[model samples]
Target: MYENLDDAELLRAALDAMNREHNADAVSLLKILVDRNPVHPYGHYLLAAEHMQLGMVDRAEEGFARAVALAPDFPIARFQLGQLYLVKGDGALAKSTLAPLADLPSGTALASYAKGLIAMVDDDVSGAVEALQTGLACEQEILPLAGDMQRLLANLMAPTEDGAFPAGVETTMSAAPLYLSAYGKTDP
Candidate 1:
């Protein structure tokens, strides 16, 4: 049904579907968008997000990776890919993937998120909590991502059975799923 729409229109329709919580329709539209415009990074990114929402980790990784490969400077895509790796228990790859985000302005949400993930991988619970809190404080552009980070932070800071916090950062990645906002004319 969406085949008749041009790329821009298709993206808008997909965004509308997502806003309305019609994930299946949004996924269908995004798949068509990516198939028709294979080189558009946002299309791949959006499809990857749908895959993530559906618990299809492998597909999400592939889509996010494609998006990052097509647009190296796309910080959100890069951060998501890296976080995916971190969640999958691949710390080395996650660190490598998130490394470039360090070059972003230091106080930006993406930068803080990357730092938080890196600290988590290193088992530094306190550091991760601090960075994630900092990220939540300043996050503006991508509210969905900020919400995801907030959930992650809450999980990380949750206390253990004995009323003491966990000594190290355990992989609570599954406690919060990645939430992606729809892209507009500008790339997120």
Candidate 2:
């Protein structure tokens, strides 16, 4: 049934599947799409992201690297690759990988976050704070919740030199449900 759909439709379906947490189906659909069009950058990017979500780091890296190679001007792929490198403790590669993100519009949250990461890497806490504040200020219109943004700003500035963000930062981030409940947010 899917074979009859065009590339765009197939991609949409794959993205929907991925968003719905059907990684295996997303991978299957994306594999077919990529097999049909080897140079499709978005296809490779989505496939790589799905693999990453599935804990297939090696394949995810390969897909993300290929996506970056195919679309040199794309910043999101580069950001993902750079972050992956950072997670893997390849700071040098992460720095070089994220260098291009600076060329993106400074007002964008994406660019600001990338700059903040780089500043942190360079041990410039103040610079990171300033850039992040600027980014958040610039992107306020799209900020999901005003309270969340305020919390983020406060937590961001409260980090000790040795810690990443504040004490509750990682917890709220990676464990959103627990964080929300702990903060008495689960009323229903």
Candidate 3:
């Protein structure tokens, strides 16, 4: 746990461990950090992330909640909490939690994607397209959502009800090529 280190060093070590996927070591260090400095919002957030990586949803949610309580203006914590609500299928809660992301987050791309997902879940097709397009324009690196948005847009724009994409639809991607990997599980 690097007991000899100060708070900042401990946090760095915890984050380093987390980035390396050593969640157990990160959790141990973060537990000590939060224990020593209960008011440390980032400490709580890091702890929450480690907990999430360990598949401990309740603890992760609790830690995230604590971080929010400690620092209400932290957009990342709010975004994460909203994602958690969405994953839990609490659409109303997720919407309310994510309402601020339309303007407040450091980058709005993820927020827009989330908004698009919420709109799609709510059957607001036009709203979904608007949000997805806005998000893609803001950051092309957000390509994981492109496939979903493309499918949805195709459905909405299809002349027929056959569930097929329109002919001559732009096949070229403006975003970088994407890997076939799962998202919305860890970072969304």
Candidate 4:
């Protein structure tokens, strides 16, 4: 069915399949592409992600390693590789890969997110909430993801004492519900 599609289109189809929870189908499609183009970093990356979603950690790690080998500087692949290591409880490797990303301005929010994941793994709930919230603040374009994260953090870090709002923060928060309503989505 994907014979006429270009590589990027094939990748999009695989992502759509993954989003719809058809992980086996996504893997099959990605495997076809990877078999034909072994060095295609995106093919490896997509397969790696599918394997990760399916909880096949060993296969996921192998696929991610191949992606990194094929495209050493591919930021998304590197980020996911770090995440795989984090999931495997390989803190040393995760830190080694993710720490350098923090110094790059474009990678700042992602690096912060990785830190939050690490904190959660370490059972430091407060640190996770703080780090993820900071990351969400720094990357407002990630509204859907950040909104869910903000709700989770708010619940986790509910204030114990009454506090004054920063100048426009309350106004911004109050307006958010209106904006979300206008967009026909519930705030998470």
- The candidate scoring highest on lDDT is 1
lDDT of each: 0.80, 0.67, 0.64, 0.62
| Tens-place lDDT digits, model 3, residues 143-177 | 54556456545555556455343342223111111
Please give the lDDT score at residue 70 for candidate 3: 93
Q: For candidate 4, give the lDDT of residue 29.
A: 82
| Candidate 2 clash figure, as a count | 0
Q: Quick one: best TM-score, which candidate?
A: 1
Show pairs that collide, candidate 1. Answer: none
Q: Where does candidate 3 clash, by residue pair?
A: none
* All candidates in order of lDDT, best leading: 1, 2, 3, 4
Q: On residues 64-174, what C-alpha lDDT tens digit does candidate 4 reach at each position?
A: 789888987765566567755764568678767666555456435666666665665465667767777778768554455456446545654655344322233333332
What are the models' TM-scores? 0.85, 0.76, 0.69, 0.64
Off by over 4 Å in 1: 158-171, 178-188
Question: How big is the positional error of residue 173 in model 4, measured in Å on the Cα after superposition?
Answer: 28
Residue 12, candidate 4: how far off, in angstroms? 3.4
Work out candidate 2's RMSD over C-alphas: 7.1
Q: What is candidate 1's lDDT per residue for 1-188, written digit by digit as tens?
A: 66679998989888788778788998999999998999989889888888887889999899999999999998888988898888788999999999899668977988998998888788787888899988888846777677777777887788777644364434447534445433222334
Q: What is the lDDT of residue 119 in candidate 4?
A: 62
**lDDT tens readout by residue for model 2, 101-137:** 8668767776776776577567565776776676677
Q: What value does the lDDT take at residue 182 in candidate 2?
A: 16
